[model samples]
Target: MRYVHLYFTCIKRSMISRLEYKKDTVVALFSFFFSNLCSLAAVYFILQAIPALAGYTLAEVGFFYGFSMLPISLDHLFSDEFWLVAYRRVKDGDMDMHFLRPVPVIFQIFAETFQPEGFGEMILGVALIAVCAGQLTVSLTVGALVVLCVGAVFGAVIITSLKVAIAALAFIFKRSGPLLQIIYNFSNYAKYPLAIYPFFIRTLLIFVLPFGLFISLPVDTLLTGAHDPWLLSLAIIGAAAVFFALALWIWTRCERRYESTGS
Candidate 1:
């Protein structure tokens, strides 16, 4: 427990150090916030003219955008390393130091480059949530809040694991960024309500890819009482398990591909 706290403390300190050293940190952070706001604004403006996106209300669409973004933003903040894991580790051979570390290579990578600028997006998400709370009427029950928290954490884990698994494949293939980017693009579909999608489309998002569960569907359930909360929780746990196993398997298989210069 102490180590866990220290780990996060280190991450916070690292972020503070970077912000202090880089004069443009604040600018970068605000830029991120405005960029996200711009995206949300475009959605809001489009929805203002249109009655509904499929079956989702304007407020619900707002909630969906905010909620879906929460997971991706958090993932970007922490797992940014995964996106560069292959390119940096392999091409530059910088992974040598990681193998010498006491902690896991992945943890070390994540800890080394913790970007808190993502906090800006997170704050925007919170503000969006507040707006959605006001716009969309729902019973703010203790049970529902607990469910949402669980779902969010699970969503983060699943997204992280998906990234890890995909990045781990870079061990076998040097240039994996384009492939990862494509996967990220596909995951963006969850930024809106999946309910309006056809049966096959919904099934593909919910089961095959599972990004739809991250925000749209779960938050939709919270807003409209459309689906079982327990199902979201279960899906998060299940997806995390499956993806984690796959990542571990790939990492182990590719460990042999690792060649350190220190030897």
Candidate 2:
């Protein structure tokens, strides 16, 4: 409970600090929002011409695009600073400050450097979910809805785990920004039904990268029922566990080898 209070405190401080640069923050927010809106437009135009891509209808594809955004947006809102601060601070030798803090360095990084721009993606994500939920053919029960919501929470953690794991590579490489982005962009596959892609791409998305686990598979479980829930659920657990454990191990190794600017 004490740690929870500290976590909230970290977020509070970050928000207050961000509010000091209100204009810049708002601009960033709208810029990201507009960017995401353009993506939705692109999808709309594609479906307008073809009527259906693979077997999914317009509403089904839109639901996949929108519903999946919720968890990714949530991660961007909170845990994105892991990449922002980890890379920059390490390169600039500013990581020394974190060692002096009483809390864990990873926790400090995530909590301190908040990015409010993610609200752009987050707002549209929720709106998309609403628009598609009304049109979905599935008769999702209250219990099923709750299950999918839980899946969203897991999806956010999975995304963060991947980000932190990749970003942690910065501790050794000193410039993991591009590498991290390369892995992050793999989630672009989540925008459509996995069946539309080639077999290799689907395999990578499901097991190796597991971007398929983000929102699509969980939403599919909610809609179609989890005949093979383990296909996605276990893969998510396995992916997050592997990546997060690797990040922590690497972080520990790097911390032990750290040579501060003054030391």
Candidate 3:
């Protein structure tokens, strides 16, 4: 409870810092909105040409894309600071301040940024899901809805755990941005139906990076009844717990190796 309060207090401070530059915040909001808009437009244009992707209809594809954004946007909202840590902070000794805090360094990093830009993605994603869901014929089940909710919330935890684990590598290597970028780019593949990909790529997305596990699988269950929703929800929750625990372990181990650049 104390940690929860501290987390919100830190988030409030971060929000105040960002809100001080109101114009910049607005610009950031629009930039993320339009960026997502452009991506959706591209998907629309491609569907116009191909009509369907891997037996998935246009509305179904849009639903997949929209649902995919939920986990990514949530991760972007809460863990944007990890990007800086992965790319530059450890190398530049910017992490020294975090280490000096009485709290855990990982907690400090998590609280360092509260990106309002992600709200743009969240709004657009929810709007797209609503619009596309209305066009689809599939009936959503109670179990399916529960799985989707679990996928969205716990999926964010999975992505954030991956980021935390990757960023911790910087403590040892001094920069893990390129590797993190490469791994994160895999999430883009999850934006479409996994059936569109080859067997190996599909396996990698589900078992290795596991982006498709949470994003594509839940949507597939809803649209095609591909998996047992109750089991899938359990799998997602278990995966999230395992990934988060492993990430914390990795971060704690790697953190001990950090040495200031003394720059």
Candidate 4:
């Protein structure tokens, strides 16, 4: 419970701090919301002409799009600061303060820089998930529902772990702004069905990039009907756990090696 308490306290303070810059906050929110609109609208228009992609209806495709994005949106809400860390904090020596804090370094980093504008993605993603889910042919069974709820958490963890590993790279290189953007932009593939891609791309999404775990696998189970569908959820949870350990190991190693710029 102490962790929960710490999270709420940090987030509350961060929210208040951000609210002081109302114009920047409001403008960023609007910009991100419109960006999401453009992506969704692009997919909408494409599906209208193609009729179906990889054997799924527009509704199923929508579910895939939003389900994949939902966890990512949540990750951005909490860990957007990791981008700042990658871009400037380590290089400028601001991360020195994070090490001095009593809280876990990661928790302190995330809690100190909450960006509420990230919720624009969450809002649209959830609305799309809800409306598209209703149009799915398979109803949500109790077990499937539990898998999705649990899997969503693992999904968020996977994204956070990816950023953590990437940002931790800043500890070594001091700055790699473009690398972070490259990795993040690769997630655009997750917005579509992984199966629609070629074999090599499919492998990357499932194993290397693993964005398919966030959306396609679970939705595939729902569409195709699995006797032991929970296994897929277990796989996601297990993969996330493994990746998290790896990310933390990288962060710890780099933390030891970090040399503050002292500027």
Candidate 5:
């Protein structure tokens, strides 16, 4: 409870800092919104040209794309500071301030930024999902709805865990941003139906990076009834728990290796 209060307090401070430049905030929000809009438009154009992708219709593809944004946007909202840590802060010894704080360094990093730009993505994503869902003929089941909710919420946990684990490597290597970028790029592959990919790429997305596990699989379940929703939801929730625990372990171990650059 104390930690939860501290988290909100830190988030409030971060929000104040960001809102200090109201124009910049508005610009950033619009920028993210348009960026996502452009991507969605690209998908629409391609679907119009090709008509279908790997047996998935245009609406199915749109639903997949829209659902992909949920986990990514949530991660972007809460953990944007991890990008700075991975790319700059540790190398510049900027994390010294976080180390001096009473709270855990990881907690401080999590609380350091509250990105309002992600609201743009969230709004656009929800809107796209609603639009695409209306065009599809999906039978809504209790299990299916549960899986979608779990996938979106717990999927964010999985992505954030991956970010935290990768960012923590900066403590040892001084910068892990490139590797993190490479891994994160894999999430893009999840923005489409997994059936469109080759077997090996599909396996990698499911088992290795696991982006497709949470994003594509849940949507597939809804559209095609491909998997047992109860099992898939359990798998997503379980994977989130495991990934978060492993990420915390990795962060704890790597954090001990941090050395100030003395800049």
Candidate 6:
């Protein structure tokens, strides 16, 4: 409990510090919100033409798109640093400072960076969910709701683990930043109905990257009465475990090779 309080205090301090740069922060916040608004507009236009794709209505598609924003919001809230900071720390040899702290190094690193833009997105996503939910008229059992939440949580974990795994490559390679951009492009697959995708692409997403399973299938089961959500959620749990385990093992191995600038 004490550690939890300290963790939050650190985050609060970080937020306060960010507010000190009010002008720059406001610019960044507006830029991010506008970019996402553009994405939402694109989805609306695309669905306007097709009306529905692969048994999903526009509202259902919106729910999938909207539901996905929840995890993306959560990801930005907690693990945005994991996407960019790991490489910066490794390259700058500043990671040692984190190691010297009593808390877990990753925990300290994550706590220090807060994305207020993500909080803004979360508020917007909740409103979108409310609108989509009414249009979808989905029945929700207590058990199914639990599974949906678990899937969302585990889905976020898988994405974070994947980011860490990719970022850890910086320790061995000269610079992995370029490759990270390419990997980020894959996130587009999450913004649409996976059903409309080709079989091979769908297979790759499910077996290789697993992003499709993260947002699409679980939510589809909820609003559309698809089936086997419990089993699917368990599969997500398994996939998240595998992804994180591999990432942890790799990160541990790479830590030994870290060379600090400061003696």
TM-score versus the correct structure, for each prediction: 0.86, 0.88, 0.96, 0.91, 0.96, 0.88
For model 6, the run of ten residues with the poorest summed lDDT: 81-90
Please write out the lDDT profile of model 4 over residues 13-41, one tens digit for every residue. 88888889889977887888888889989
lDDT (Cα) of model 4 = 0.81
Taking the tens digit of each residue's C-alpha lDDT, what string does model 2 give over 150-262?
55677777778778776677777676778888888887777777767888888888777777865667766766675355555565666667867876777667665555656
119-151 in candidate 3: lDDT tens per residue? 778888899999999999999899889999999
Compute the lDDT of residue 86 as modeled in candidate 3. Answer: 97
Error of 1 at 100 (Å): 3.0
User: Model-by-model lDDT, in order?
Assistant: 0.74, 0.74, 0.92, 0.81, 0.90, 0.76
lDDT of 5 by residue, 143-181 (tens): 889998998999999999999999999999999999999
Report per-prediction Cα RMSD to one decimal. Answer: 2.8, 2.6, 1.3, 2.0, 1.3, 2.4
Q: How accurate locally is residue 66 in candidate 2, as Cα lDDT from 0 to 100?
A: 84
- What tens digits encode model 6's per-residue C-alpha lDDT throughout 85-122? 55476777767777777786667767878787888888
User: With candidate 3 superimposed using the best TM-score fit, by how many Å does residue 206's alpha carbon deviate from the native?
Assistant: 0.7
Clash tally for model 3 = 0
Q: Using lDDT as the measure, which candidate wins? A: 3
**Residue by residue across 1-263, what tens digits does model 1's lDDT show?**
76577568868877777867675876787788788878878988888898888877887778777777677777778887777775566555667777886777766667766777667677778788889879776886654565567667777777777777777777767657777788777666788877677899888877767788667667867877776777767777788788778877877777567665453
